[model samples]
Target: MSDLAHLPATQALKLFRTRALSPVELMTAVIERAEAVEPRVNALSETMFEQALEQARKAEHAYVHGEPRPLEGLPVATKDEQPIAGRRASDGSLAYAGHVADTTHPVVERVIAAGGIVHARTTTPEFCCAAYTHSRLWGITRNPWNLDYSPGGSSGGAGAALASGTATLATGSDIGGSIRLPAAATGTVGYKPPYGRVPAMSPYNLDHYCHDGPMARTVADCALLQNVIVGPHPADVVSIRPAVHVPERLGDVAGLRIAYSPDLGNWEIEPDVAANTRAVADALATAGAVVEQVEVPLRRADVMRAAFIHFGAIFGPMVAGVADAHRDELTPYALAFAEDSRAALARDGFLAGLELEGRIYAVIGDLLDRYDALICPTAGAAALPAGEDYVDTKLTVNGVQLDHYLEYSLTPVFNIAGRCPVLNVPSGLSSYGVPTGVQIVGRSYDDATVFRIGAAVERVLPWPTRPQL
Candidate 1:
């Protein structure tokens, strides 16, 4: 039997509404689970025991009084980057290690108003930059499936906690695949809403590529959280006005056109990863979706140029002041990349890249004009072994040597295009016993479509009941 009583928010909500389980009882179980797994996963930085219990007590009263909120009493974890009033909003760096938010971030405020209780701040990469979730302040967040592997980053802790059943649901932010990569690594479901779907106020205003969204063990529960956190804030120009309706139903896939790209046409993908994802396409076909292998037009474009320019813009000014003082502490690759950004990229380059990105986005739009969704592996390999910073370039699959970090190549494309995509289901275990995931790409502003397709795919895919921690 699963020791921590693994329950998704949907079922937990049912019990909460029926008064079958008190909020205190649920909170106790969640806290116990988190405590139980912390030694191995290192997924959480700080647990808000007293505050969470206080909120649970109030939630129990509300439930008994029949005044339940949208998430009434449900336990939720937040990425450490989200500002939580008195709690530290450490971006997993020594630079801002002890900093506290004076007020809650808009998303955190919304979740609180909707009746969710926050118990902890999950770990993140330094300044939320790296693909692996490890930092000087919080150490490393390991995979729930196998403690020796990564859970993905910068929202790595959120994914790890969900997979370990440490919390019912968690929030994740995506900028260059932060949310999706971790979700893929931990075998959880993560969604990247269209740019501005969830209002954000970053110090840098990363409206172009950054997104804050929901992650969970199941789709319906993810939708439940999404329903609560979306809508416009006056401070955010890009936030979409409330979505007219949040989809609760998983649509049938019988007639949907699913474009399957095993390697996204030109990118490098491992053979085992390709085979595992190919099996998903076959499963979708069996589920009655019309599946076809198609070449991604961007694959033929100067993607490396596009990726470098886009990244350089975001990291250039971010580290300009600290590069000299922190040079010794920063990773060699990051320092090298930052120096390159300082030397060459400029405002015109970023604007030009944005313009180019828009044109390429139109190409994807053209493809979506004919197809309902795109399906592919979320990463080229399973989670890397523990303590490994980057996957080895020598790892080859089907005669392909990985060029960049295997995880980024798959999920960063959607971020560049501002598409609403979801990492739906795990393909299954690797020979090393780590988990792998599949990506479901949908059209802009069509997050529900991705959710619908992901739900269907999840039903068809063989989701693991428990990770071998």
Candidate 2:
């Protein structure tokens, strides 16, 4: 039963097809796993076990008596950031605790249509702003590997659930490393498809920095979910047409020219993270991929300044608008984020942000032009405290204190360079047991190459599917 809970979606689907494993059996085991570990991990906002079991039974009927859909009976944990018409869409804020959405997000709609059963709603930071996952409404979502540390947000709960064996597949959104950070912290596979690969809610769908993607225990499973959720939607004007397809057999990266960026030239990364990143580079080289170390001509401060300015011009105003109406009800970090965004908007302005974005992309674009994919650490720090708020403090890395806590991650630059498809795969674990990850960045709209590289990496350096929970 325990093994069944941690089974990969692809393998489980095979079992269902062979009539070897009934959908009800998998759903029940998953529900039991959730009930057992959720008290410690606290990853779910709400569970639909009753509904999931019913769906699973229906899936079994379809398999036995009719045609089963692509996903068939798989359990998917939906990100709380997306709406599901008639369900509460709190945005992880107390102000909207009673708010209910009237429409389903395109990603969720696709998941349901593909026969994926949503068993739970995952937690996120308020308005999905912070790198850590905690809100006044949902409390703290801890890592399954180390309860003292966070799973990484704003998709923290999804990562935690995957690592804890409570979920086989989960959805995530990345504006500033939300998906990759959690995947790094929890030893999971996460994909941040090029901005328009997966359809999203309006406004954000137009914001190139935003991407809704997939998170799972393996690259194959991540691809499984990504293929189902991607494609154009009538409601989202910016969604890409003729949806990109992920090939099932991503054979190998035997002759691929892969580039490596150890520190991106400027950010101060911890010694462990640097070592793990190099280890991945070494593994890629061993697999016949030409992994060459390259220099990133960029500064952490400049990249973050542009990210904040962009956020200020777009996401910041939305959060600030909410804050203006309900100052007392918001989380302290959310309030701080709003204030910081307003200040950023005033200082750098939108046009300046656009210029900086172009400069940032020029660096990545140039690198990708020379190489098939670029590799780098997902986050500089291995883990962050689950419950502590780093809103007001400067974070330290490599014994050097930084100006801002968010500087610890190397994820925002990719958001600025929004056209590249980036996938996060585990590199190694810290001495403290927290996981570290590296990103495989591909050329614009070239999603298959990144997944191919990811599949190669997974074959060489496999990540443990479940924490020792």
The candidate that wins on TM-score is: 2
| Per-residue C-alpha lDDT of model 1 across residues 30-50, encoded as one tens digit per residue | 888777778999988888978
Q: Which 10-residue span in candidate 2 carries the lowest summed lDDT?
A: 386-395
CA lDDT, candidate 2, residue 221: 97
Q: Which regions of candidate 1 deviate over 4 angstroms?
A: 1-5, 203-206, 328-337, 343-348, 391-403, 406-408
**TM-scores of all candidate predictions against the true structure:** 0.93, 0.99
TM-score, cand. 2 vs. native: 0.99
lDDT of 2 by residue, 1-469 (tens): 7899999999999999999999999999999999999999999998999999999999999899868998999999999999999999899999999999999999999999999999999999999999999999989999999899999999999999999989999999999999999999999999999988899988899899999999999999999999999899898888989997899888888989999999997888888899999999999999999989999998999889999998898898999999999999998888888889889989878999899889988988889889999999998899898887787667788898988788999999999999999999999998789999999999998999999998988999887877887
Model 1 weakest lDDT span, ten residues long? 389-398
